[model samples]
Target: MFSKDVVRYHHGHDHDHDHCHEHTHTRGAEVENKDEKTLKILLLHWVNHNETHEEGFREWVEKAREIGKEETASHIEKAIEYMQKANEMLIEAKKHM
Candidate 1:
């Protein structure tokens, strides 16, 4: 569960008003140009975290193979494929920076 403070901070919520998008708020910006640098940093962090998860999934795949659980291994392989696609999408997004 997300706390009120987290909601206020991340969603740019103002207690004076009853509203929150909870995602993609630009409350901190005071100029025409949005903060691309911060967004890039966030994307890089996401990529790093996804890579870590991929490593864990790889371990699970190896363990499944060792235990002769091909079905489980195949599922992890599909997850890894999705992860790779996500990483590729992020890489494509970086090109805009």
Candidate 2:
């Protein structure tokens, strides 16, 4: 039988566990990392934001093509590709959310 379950067995090994923190400091800036609940919301927001930008980028690509600006279209496509990478990252980050 294949049991897909998460059973927590604490054998006094507390040093090898993953947990999310509420805040983080970077470059002397105190940033609110937020807890799991907030993270889920933020992840969903980023997913929407990235998707919107991706669509806008594609539209720009089409506009560039319409004007026979092959170079601009190519650059916009590259930007779309980069936006896709960011989308992938945001999707993966949902694991923590």
Candidate 3:
């Protein structure tokens, strides 16, 4: 008789191994990285502060465009791009922190 039921294992899956890998790190060493620490703080700050900044930036850009201020709109657009990059970096830093 052919068994209709089948089991599948995906990446990082170990059928025979019932336990997960354990990671160890030195105390204070991980947290002492200035860049990483700064990133974590920035991430948290952004999570709270980004909403206002993003909304204002969007509104300003839209208004600028509506008024046919192409130069100002372009500048605001560039600033938005930079803020996006900064936000992304903070996110990545949080992952490491």
Candidate 4:
């Protein structure tokens, strides 16, 4: 569950872009630009969320192997590896930010 302190902030760009960005703002003062700050928050959230999902996937992998689904389990393990790689990139991005 998301914390009550975090609130969703929908902000529209004044540029010619046709799409609007939806960002989350925690209850506090922000010195950074809105878009960059929200992006950093989102990246952290995604990393944590991915960790939870990876744990669930590992549990399923064990169950799959127990039921004689070795191939399926292998695929899920590969997916977990890919997710780790993606998270590494996200972390790097946040570092640059």
Candidate 1 residue spans exceeding 4 A from truth: 1-34
Q: Model 4: per-residue lDDT, tens digit, 1-96?
A: 223343333542121212225454664444256666668777887788678779989999999999999999999999999999999999998999
Best by lDDT: 4
Model 3, residue 72: displacement in angstroms?
Answer: 0.4
lDDT of 4: 0.75
Better of 1 and 2 by lDDT: 1
* lDDT scores of the candidates, listed in order: 0.71, 0.67, 0.63, 0.75
Q: Which stretches of candidate 3 lie over 4 Å from their true place?
A: 1-42
TM-score between model 2 and native? 0.59
Model 2, range 1-97, lDDT digits (tens) per residue? 1223333545332222233444455633234434455577657766776677688788888998999999999998998888888878988989755
TM-score of each: 0.63, 0.59, 0.54, 0.69
Q: Which candidate is the best by TM-score?
A: 4
Whole-model lDDT, candidate 2?
0.67
User: How many clashing pairs per prediction, in order?
Assistant: 0, 0, 0, 0
Q: For model 1, what is the error of residue 72's alpha carbon versus the real structure, in angstroms, after optimal superposition?
A: 0.6
Writing each residue's lDDT as its tens digit, candidate 1 over 1-97 gives: 1123322344343232222223544665533234564567557766776787799899999999999999999999999999989998998898887
